[model samples]
Target: MSTAMAPEPVDNGGDARTRRSIARAVLANPTMVTFGALAVIILAFSALAPGLFTQGSNFVQLAQNVAILTVVSVGTTFVIITAGVDLSIPSGIVLGQVFAVQALKLLPLGEGTTAFDATANQTTALSVLVAVTAALLGGLIIGLINGVVVAYLRVPPLLATLGTLGAGLGVALILQDGVNSATYALDPVGNGALIAGIPNLIPIALVVVIAGFVLLHLSVFGRHTYAIGSNPEAARRVGINVERHLLKVYVLGGVASGLAGFLSLSYFSTTSIGGFSTANLQAITAVALGGTSLFGGVGSIIGTLIGVWIPAVLKNGFIITGVQPYWQDVAVGFVLIAAVWFDQLRRRSRDRG
Candidate 1:
């Protein structure tokens, strides 16, 4: 003790502070954290279902399966980023598909009486375009009505969309005359393969994602959207037209759903009323999982892209591993819960810092 000086300080506090800083940085960006989670899931599935999960064909199939949902989720992302929810997405999608098919039927292009005739040479490219346009118009009308109800009438988004959800389904059923299925001779968007074995749907979805990213990240409208979601009163005080913006957001959502309907028709060649039973839940779950806070104002399209794939991979993995279909829902439920929990934690940490 007499010969030795006191041991130098270990500086353990400094190291601990550094570690805390790293953790906070990682948590600050939900997209990064979600990507990490997605990577872990992929690795786990690769191990559990080694052959099929990682195969090229399986990847293509996964892309095809998720394309419609991805398109629909884009709209959901827009609505959610503004601190709003649209329960009408599923209905919007179904209505869009049904309307497209009916348009083809009513405006047959050639010698066929029904749009579903394989022998009919009636499906011209122009007819397809017109049918798709009509479907999109229907979606726009529905979205506009929702906007008016929520913005002008001051109804909450949930209740307003909930009413529209039922109305949409009712309208779809009436259009199809309660038919369980309807077919069309529209050209298949999936008939050709692109580079890396990716189908046309992949490119189409990429366009949607890129467009959405630009709209939300690079445009003034995106800024206003964030402002409103972060605080409506404050946004208004700053000269943001909250009602008009909300209306536009809803309408955008509708257009997206309509596009998804077109994609669905291309992929499946038929519109089944029961096929989209879980679509609304899936789109919402994807958006939530992508790290977009339900509370609004903070979100990313890149995150939504990752989120859409998570469920697609999960379902495909489960099916490959012989897991029951119901377990897929269970797994998705857990993912949603975990996402919300992490979101709350991040908010709290931000406040503390």
Candidate 2:
């Protein structure tokens, strides 16, 4: 009875398998890492400036602050997923704003009256709608041209967008007669808070993000985008119209940029020619930081959502903590580098496995 019983067998293989499965899951969803980092940053900021960072008003401000960037980043996400770069986003935003404002100024709402003049020839709602439509059309035309050049003409995306960037800015400048700033009487409506101290920009941004998620994750167009990005030849072999799909992706990006322009015009009640110079860089950086691969074929809209907020939170937190504005750029640069490095490491790990 006292004899030693047989030792229970160790389930080393099972344990190892479980561990591998967990690792695979983590690797498959890189957003987990970005989300974790965002949480940490928030916590750190809260700790650094407890009263300031934790305030309800500050959070609302942060939401309104990042609204424009979030909208633009959604479009940038699509282009990046296709392994294409668009340098024209900033120009697109400017164009949209300029177009909207110019339409309000030039379009004959009534006899010898423009939307800006408030002559009562047209209802405020109709004027806003018409101007918004014109802004969107401006963006659409630019996007279509970019897509045509890149997809059908076999031009590189970077070159095509860069060319458009210059051209778009020139057009916007011409429309404004080289004026650095232009304002409209509807500034209050455009930038006013709609609900609970939240600016109208927030709701518009939410709609864009939601629509982008649906388009990217739940639509056939999204599937083709991923396929084309992953392997164009394979996608072509499968009868996927690669060129047409690419064109659509660019157009979508353009539309998003246009939407952002409208929002910006509303929020600021003014269009500044040089105000959004850094917009393209910020959008691309946010996309990359959100776990979207610059090499294409791997991306997530949810990740982009989180990515757009991180920099915004950082800048806000830094200001509260008395950190210099320039340092924010430095911090963002490091984060960008770290994100790319992580991507490289992940790629290497997959290759080895």
lDDT of 1: 0.82
**Model 2 CA lDDT for position 326:** 73
Model 2 regions more than 4 Å off: 1-24, 109-111, 119-123
Per-prediction backbone clash count: 0, 1
What's each prediction's TM-score?
A: 0.89, 0.90
Candidate 1: pairs in clash: none
Q: Which candidate tops lDDT?
A: 2
User: lDDT per residue, candidate 1, 241-318, as tens digits?
Assistant: 899999999999988888888778766777766677677778888898999988999998999999999877888888
| TM-score, prediction 1 | 0.89
Per residue, candidate 2 scores C-alpha lDDT tens digits across 1-353 of 33457656554778778799777787667787888888999999999999999999898788888989999899999999999978898888889888888778875656776786653233377677866887787778778888999999989999999999889999999988998555564565566665757777788788888998999999998888888887899999989989999999898888788878877877777886788888989999999999999888888999998888888888889999999867778888898888878887887777653
- Candidate-wise lDDT, in order: 0.82, 0.84
Deviation in Å, model 1, residue 293 alpha carbon: 0.9
